[model samples]
Target: MKTFLFRSMIGIFFGAFLAVAITNCAVYFGGQELLDGETFLKNSLGSIFCGWFFTVSPLYFELKNLRLSQQTALHFMTVTILYFSLSFWIGWIPLHLKSILFFSGMFLTTYAIIWLSFYFYFKNIAKKLNQDLENI
Candidate 1:
């Protein structure tokens, strides 16, 4: 419980930082005021929630009965739902089928890349550890 609280605190701050950074970048690059005050607040809060959820969601994997694939799938589904719902609510994405689909594709692609990178990274670490054990 203490560890979870600590992680949640970290996640909230990280999420806030990310939200501000992303917003600033969008304002700078897009060359337009992207959000009014109310919307900006909503976006910021939504981002914090997302950060918290993402950080904590890995706890689901601690369930010994679920396979890795199952854990990943469940996490992915929850994240997708949370992200898109927030996106739409925060007015980041237009409430149109085409826009939703396009964003969904982009999000899925990015998620897959990150997930694969982590998977391979841990796999390499495991392999190296096993090799060292064999040498021992």
Candidate 2:
């Protein structure tokens, strides 16, 4: 529980940071004024909520009962849908076919990247642990 809270705090910090960074980059590059303070606050809070929800949702599931492939597929689909809906609702993404497709592609790419990175990291840790056990 303490670990979960710690991770949630980190996730919210990064999520808010990413949200601001991306918005700042887009507005700066486009030569547009920043969003009004209230709007920016809303967006930032939305991002924080999204991050919290994402972490909590996965914890509610019993992924250990599923195979690795199943877990990956479930995580991919759930996260993609959850993010799409949240983004669209919060006006980060537009509600149109092209926007949906583009967002989906981007989400899928990032999801795969993060998932594969963790997959390899944990696999390496397990391998090292096995070697140590053998030495013992």
Candidate 3:
């Protein structure tokens, strides 16, 4: 319970940070402004939720520490495939049966974000787990 709470907290903050970073980059390079705060917030929320790998990896390792079952790995694979497929399809939906770039970029970016997110998430989890175990 405690570890999950900690993970959730970490995930929320990291998600927000990621959202803001991506949004800012988009605006800076794309030179497009949001029509309203609502739009910005919606987009940010989407960005944050998309980075669940941040919380998932640590939760997996945490489960390992607790000597939990291997279902975690199974869930990870399921969630991963689902995330990629959904993101890819939804991202290029507007392309409407045409446009390779749309699908390609969407697929690549989805995977890229997952990879980057997990890198930081797993790194932090490892550090904290060591600290936690040492104190135990």
Candidate 4:
């Protein structure tokens, strides 16, 4: 519980940092206007929750009974649902069908790239470990 709380705190801060950075970039490069106080607060809270979820979600992989594929699928689905819901609520994603579809594609592509990167990274580590063990 303590560890979980600690991670959650870290996640919240990290999320806030990301939200600020992204907002700054958008305002600077995209000519987007700064959000008003109430809207900004709402978006920030949503981002923090997203950060918390992303941070703690890896804990799901620790479940012994579930295969890695199952864990990945569950995590992906959970993230998708949470992100879409929050995105819509925060007005980051417009309610139009075309906007939804476009964002969904972008989200899935980004998720796949991240997932593959981690998958290969850990697989390389495991391979190295196995090779080291064989040399012992």
- Against the true structure, whose lDDT is highest? 4
Top TM-score: which candidate number? 4
Root-mean-square deviation of Cα positions for candidate 3 versus the true structure, in angstroms: 7.0
**What would the per-residue lDDT of candidate 1 be over residues 1-136, giving only the tens digit for each residue?**
8868987998899999999998999899988665788877898999999898888777766778999999899989888888888888888899999998899899989999988998899999999999999999
Clash pairs, candidate 1, are: none
What tens digits encode model 4's per-residue C-alpha lDDT throughout 91-129? 989999999999999999999999999999999999999
Better of 2 and 4 by lDDT: 4
Q: Model 2, range 63-123, lDDT digits (tens) per residue?
A: 5778887776776677767777778888989988998898778877887797789889989
lDDT of every predicted structure (CA atoms):
0.88, 0.78, 0.64, 0.89
- Candidate 1 has its poorest 10 consecutive residues by lDDT at 32-41
Compute each candidate's TM-score over C-alphas: 0.86, 0.73, 0.51, 0.88
* Candidate 3 to truth, TM: 0.51
| Worst 10-residue lDDT window, candidate 4 | 32-41
